[model samples]
Target: MNDLIPLISSSINDTLASLSHFYAEIILAAGFLLVILADLFLSRRFTQLCFLISLSTLLLLGVQSVILLNTKTVFLFGGMLKLDHTSILFKLLFCFSSLLFAIFIRYNSPLQKHVKGTGDLFAILLATLLGMNLLAMSMNLLMVYISIEMVSLGSYLMVSYISADKAQTESAMKYALFGAVCSAIMLYGISLLYGFTGTLNFNDPAFINALKNVSGLSSGVAISLVFIGVAFKLSIAPLHFWAPDVYEGAPTPVTAFLSTAPKIAGFAILIGLLPVFQSEGGQTNTQYFDFNVILAVLATASMLIGNFTAIWQNNVKRMLAYSSIGHTGFMLMALFAFQGSGFQALIFYMAVYIVMNMAAFLIVDEIEEQTGILLIDEYKGMGKSNAMLMTTFVIVLVSLTGLPPTVGFTAKFLVFSSAFEAYRNTDSAVILIMIITAAISTLVSLFYYFKIPLNAFLRNSQIQVMAPGNSPKAYLGLLLAILLLVLIVFPSVIVKLI
Candidate 1:
């Protein structure tokens, strides 16, 4: 008891010192509280005040994150959280995506009309953003599970917050149940790993040595179980069954947030875990099991399943949900093939993806608002009526398909080049297979992505669709699409930032 008193005092002092490095997260936490209070107290008179506060909070948090970009890596909370350039970049990304999501929710009629109000939704976003920030920086298994559940619970609440119909409620239930199961499996896996290593820090030398001494089959099973939670968040391969229904049923803004921020956060967590599969000298440590082959197989399966299944979907949101899965596979390839420049390439690809996806969904929401049509077939003959909007949508889709004169092409080129470089260095057949699968998936994506333009321009529809108003959503989509073109010509802009 005497010894424990000093230890606890020292620990508290260390934590207080660590708080200096955690200002951005602190601000976000405070913002979450303030937003909730405002929602409860002032929402009756100032309906849009919550939206304004949410946007401001995200903007300020983004600025705070950017300021920390050049700071040295700092491990806080006794190595539970790691603050580095990569984590800062990811945090900024989440903040930016959350900003856009706030705007999207403000403009969304369905969400605005909900009885519960959007203020709670903003609070949920802040919570999820905090979770993702923690996820990006987590180094301890306990921190990982806590951060993941933070994001998952916030996501579940966001989906069900404005449940106006049966579909929305059903989607929430499915997401919550599946997420709970995955979390449980992940917790069990963590316990197994802890039992094996007697430690939870993956970066610890003792943990690696312990894992190396375990049976390959045992370690593999434990690792695979842990990956189930990540796969559920990434919507990769067989674990992606919940995505389509959730995306199709949730509010468009919620779907936008779900597709961009959380998915990237999953990648952030995966990147943090990459060291588990590597040695101190940066070589693949295959003593326990070959993660390369497992990841390669998962990537291939996700690409094939997501892209091929997308072709048959009539609903645009469902189709994009599948496409998000394919993108996850591609990002997984980037992680697997990470070499000298792979990290930069992966971050750039993710940034471009967020831009393209948000723009695409914004356009989809606009079209849905104007015409009350959600089916791709319903877009027939509407091109001539909404020429500018349709043109922007086509450009966004073209970017999504990784075509020329767009940032998507540049992003894909960087990832492919990184993979090729890794293949050359390691002579790994799995990398080669992943590259081939990615190329094929890109081509497969074209058929569905082009369907939007084809239905709008080529096919003739009997129903008279009204032209979309000059709303903020349309302008936001146009701005994002234009940014894609700018990024293509100035790829160095993002590259330098990284």
Candidate 2:
């Protein structure tokens, strides 16, 4: 009992020291509580009151994050998490996405009119943003599991916030159940790893040494089990079953957030795991399990499956959901060169992706709100009355397809260049194959993405269209679309950050 006192005292000291480095996350925690309190106590008097608070919280959180970015790389919370440039970048992205979602909810009449009120939705957003921020910084296996579960729980609530229909309720249930299974599998893997290594700190040198001492087959099995949860969040194939239905059933803003922020946070974990995958230490027998090959195979399968499946989707949200899976595969290619410019490429790509998704979903929601159109075919001849929105939509789609004049193309090019550099340095056949597959998938995507422009302009309308000219949401979407083109012209804006 006397000896335990020393350990407890040391833990307290460590926590105290860590708090100075944890201002952004502290703000996130406080923001979450304030939002809930405001919703409970003050929402009845002022309906949009919670919305104002949420947006201000997000804005303040973003400023706090920028201030923290200068902090040197240091482990916090007794080494449960790390403060680093990459993690800060991921946090900024999360905040930006959540900010966009707040405005999206503001513009969404159906959600604003919901019986359950939208205040709770903002609370969930804050909670989920907190989880994602933690996810980006987690350095310990235990922290990783807790953060993932945190995000998953908030996401479940966001999906069923309205529950205006059976589909939304069912989507929420499916997400919860599937998430539970993935969490269990990942926990089992974490247990096996802890048993083998006797350490939960993955960044600890001893952890890799221990894995190196273990049999190759055991190590591979444990690693695969843990990555299943990550794959689920990134919407990689096989683990991608929940995405299409969930995205389709979710509010458009929620869909945009799911497809971008959490997925980018998932990649942050992958970035942290880079050392374990490198084959530099011959003693570690890192070559025995080729994550490059495993990831390449997964990337290929995701690309083909996502693109082909998207081609058959009539609903815009479901199609974007599937294409997001494909984009996950494409972004997975960036990790092949994780130590090089790949991290830069990944961050840039993620930023551009957030913009592209916000634009796409904004346009889709506007069309639906104005005309009750959810199908791609139903978009016919919209360009005539809604020229500005349609032009923005076309630009967004073109960017999504990785074509010229949009930042999406620049993002894809950066990733490709980074992957190519890795291949040139290592001469890995898997890298070459992944690149080829990514190119093919991009071409395949064009067929589906172009369907928007084709139906909107080239094809004539068969049904009467409601007036679809004026909308604040459409203007916001246009700004995002134009941002894509501007960034492409000045690619250095993102590149310099890298």
Candidate 3:
């Protein structure tokens, strides 16, 4: 009993020390509650009050992230979390995405016109952003599970929150049900790992060595279960059926957020969990399955499935949904190939991906508002009426295609070059197969991505189209598109920042 006193004192001390590094998250927590209160009382008088507070909170959080970029790494909450450069960068990206989400909510015609107020969405987004920040920093299996459930729960609510039609209600139910199954699988896996290692702190050397002592098949299955759960959240193949239906059915702004921020958080979790599986002392790590080989296969399969299926998609959002799955696979390839500069390339691609994806959805929302074009067939010659907007859309598609003079090109180039470097370093056939698959997937994606421009410009439309109204979302999307172009010209800007 006496020994417990010293341990308690040390635990308290570490937590207190961690608080200084936690100010940004503190502000976020405070703002989340503050928004709920503001919505309850002030929303009647000032409709946008909650929105304003959410933005301010995200703004404060973003500033804190930038300032903490150079801080030395440290464990928080008794090693449940780890504050590091990578986590800080991910936080900054998340804050930026939430800001865009808020702006999108403000200007989105469908959301704005809905009977349900946008105030609650602002609050939910703040809460979800907080979860993402924690997920990015989580170093323990316990924290990882908690943060993931938090984010998943928030997403489930968001998708169902403004259910206006049967499709939305159906999508919501599917997302929640599917997510619940994955979460259970993951929890069982965690239980197995804890039973094997007797510690939830994945960073602890004990976790690694204990797994090493475990039977090969046992450790392999346990870890693979955990991987499947995380992959499900990222909408990777064989677990990705829900994404397209949800994206097509959910509000456009919600669809955009779903595709970008949550996937990034999933990558962070995968990155942290990866080091635990790698073998030490230059020995064969056969205690676990061939982790990299499986990852490469998943990447190759995802790229092919996502791209090839996207070619047949009619709904614009559904097409992007499949494309996102392909992108997830491509990014996973980067994760598999991560060595030295490969990490940097992955980060750069993610940063660029956020911009291009958000811009695409925003522009689509604008076109939907004015022309009500939901299908690829609907875009026929509408570019003739909305030339500038369609031109912006074309440029965004160019970037998404990783063509020259767009930041998307730069992002893809870095990833491919780094992937080749990984291949040269290891001479692994798995990496070679994925590299080929990625190249082919990119070409396949062109057919779907260009379908927008081709139908918008080359095909003729008989129906008259009006120009989009003065929309804040459209302008913001345009700014993002231009930023992509600017970043390509100075590729080092975002690359070095990351």
lDDT by residue for model 1 over 258-364, one digit each (tens)?
99999998898888877664432222445456777778889989999999999999999999999999998988877755757788889999999999999999999
lDDT of 2 by residue, 1-498 (tens): 887987997899999999998888788778778878888899899888889988888999899887777668999988899988888889989998999989999988899888888888988888888889889899899889999999989988898888888888998899889988998998998898888889999899999888778877788788888888888888898899899999999888888888988888788777776665442246645566767688889988898899989999999999999999999998888887878888888889989999999899999999889888999988898888678888999999999999998889889999999989989988988789889988899999999999989999998886758664667888899999989999988988766655
Number of the predicted model whose lDDT against the real structure is largest: 1
TM-score of 1: 0.97
C-alpha displacement of 245 in model 1, angstroms? 1.2
Error of 1 at 270 (Å): 0.9
- TM-score ranking from best candidate downward: 3, 1, 2
Clashing residue pairs in candidate 3 are none
Q: Which scores better on lDDT, 1 or 3?
A: 1
Q: Name model 2 segments beyond 4 Å from true.
A: 277-288
lDDT string for model 3 (41-158, tens) is: 8988998898899989999998888888988899889888999999999998888888888899888877777676888888899999989999999989988999999899999889
Clashes counted in candidate 3 amount to 0
> What's the number of clashes in each of the models?
0, 0, 0
Q: Against the hidden reference, what TM-scores do the models get?
A: 0.97, 0.97, 0.98
Alpha-carbon lDDT of model 3 = 0.88
Scanning candidate 1 in windows of ten residues, the lowest lDDT window is: 278-287
